[model samples]
Target: MTTQTPAVRLRGITKSFGSNLVVEPLDLEIGRNEFFSILGPSGCGKTTLMRMITGFETPTGGSVELDGKTVDRVSTRERDLNMLFQSYALFPHLSVYENVAFELRVRKTAKAELDTRVREALALVRMEEFAARKPAELSGGQRQRVALARAVVGRPAVVLLDEPLGALDQKLRKEMQFELKRLQREVGITFIYVTHDQEEALTMSDRIAVMSRGRVLQVASPIEIYDAPTSRFVAGFIGSCNLIDAVVESGRVVVPGLGAVPATLPDGTADGARVVVAVRPERMTLSDQPIEGGFAGVIAERVFLGDEWTYHVKAGETELTVRVPSGETSTALAGLPEGGRVWAAWPAAAGRVLPADETASPLIGSPA
Candidate 1:
């Protein structure tokens, strides 16, 4: 039996600028036709990693493989990959059609085939109507579409996008997120996207690699990354989470001041060892009346988001944030004002015990 080769593979890849190590030795594989995203804060080495894959940045150690072949010596132009930059690096003088056809023109493709490919790419991005327009004349979103068209015009085996929608407004960015996903599905090409936006990564990627500093922290699907983060940093970085310092005793994590919160201990977690328990805000439920097995608290503040209500509850010394979906059931809490006493409770499985010394800090911050 033979194993199929991955679309792209990184083995012991590392990069350094003098003594400053940027990307640590790392290994990863991106399957064919996968929408893979490398997510991290600024200076987390996500972009550096993508550049290495594109052959724009040479690695200080190890090798990069494309379809099972080592490409350490391959020049950037020879790599069958296209990159869409965050700046949307479109040509100012060229028309949209020309910009999309740039790669084909470089290859000296016959005019009939070049026209067919360019038109198809533009149509896929819904920018065929703007073919005659120049980049300066288009809006940010439209220009982004043109960039997308250009990137996929040649139908490369892999496409690299580095924060391509960072310049758009929130609404437009959300719209383009869906558009990008749809385009990827239609083309069925392996996409390696690099972005610091957690939400964007979660929304678009089939799987995400969360990185910090120069190392990959975790790689999983959106739900797995959010629901079962391997570290405190990942739990807090991927979404809003409540991390309460605790100690494991008799298979349960005992939180200070709040008493023992039922939790499942991670394997190899010795009894009486210090740990951090992570719980998503949405996993907690709030009740005005005291309930069995629930911790008592006073509502410190409440914010009415359109789809949900976020409440900060003072549970003993810990301030726990609870998210309640807005609707009839949740509206019952509307009468409760600040200082109103309530009970906060969650299922035992909701809390995940994390290693205390897994990283230097629990907070995820962009590297300097």
Candidate 2:
């Protein structure tokens, strides 16, 4: 049997507009039928990367491969892929059925096959009933579904979505997140989704490539990316983290006021080297009693987030945040008001020690 090739591959791909280098040289592979996401804030070059893939923006270096063949010289229309933009880009003069059929029509597919594929695509998106309606006559969500149907109607090798749900309301966007994943699975096509929304990437992607300042920082499964972020930028950008200044002492990092907390150290880190102890707010526990290897502090503030309570505890110059789910246990442990003394504790494995110099240096922009 022959080996199966990856759906998409980028080898040392780099791009720039004049003197501005938007996309750094990078390599990545997206598997067939995989829901892959390129996640980053604005100006991180995720859009430029997608454009390079779709042939809209040529790379200054390296090559793009689709289904085991180089496509550097291929035109966007001849790349055997489709793109879905945030605007939906459906034709106002045509009905949903016609928009879905447009690709097959352009290819001059047989009438029977085009009709069959168009209906199947519409049905896959649950838009078969609205096939006769124009873009202006449909809701934002419906139009998005129509756009998705158009993108997948021709059974392309891959479909690139550049924030397709950016136009919808928060509620609708959340709803479409699942819809896009479902449709992707049903169609059995590679989906290259680019978005700055961390939750969206974590919610829908099988694997995620997190980018910053035109560079790919880390790529892994959503859980792995969140739990084992390689750098400070990744740890802080993926979620809310308590990044505390500390100094390494063998197996533990000692915070000035909090004492020594056991943490995992990076390779080659010296005992006296400065480092940052990164911990998630939700991973920490608060108690009125002093905890071993923990910090004793007073609750400075508490934020109520419906289902969870976030407590800001002040211990000397170092402040730590702890998130506790709203429940009887939370009230008992984290219900303390301001000035109430408590101990903030976490398991040894929860603390990740990163180099001080790279702790939070790379700046991240606003979410796309």
Instruction: Please tell me which predicted candidate would have the highest lDDT against the true structure.
Output: 1
- Alpha-carbon lDDT, every model: 0.89, 0.87
| TM per prediction | 0.95, 0.94
Model 1 pairs in collision? none
Worst 10 residues of 1 by lDDT: 359-368
Q: Which regions of candidate 2 are displaced past 4 Å?
A: 1-3, 328-335, 359-368
Model 1 CA deviation exceeding 4 Å by range: 328-332, 358-368
Candidate 1 clashes: the total is: 0
Going through the candidates in order, what is the number of backbone clashes in each? 0, 0
lDDT of 2 by residue, 1-368 (tens): 97679999999999989999999898899999999999999999999999999999999999999999999999998898999999888889998999999989989999999999999999999998998999999999999999999999989999999998888999999999999999999999999999999999999999999999999988899998888777778888898998888987775678887678867665556678787878998899888888887778888898888898888989889989999888834455655678999888898789877656643432122111
TM-score of 1: 0.95
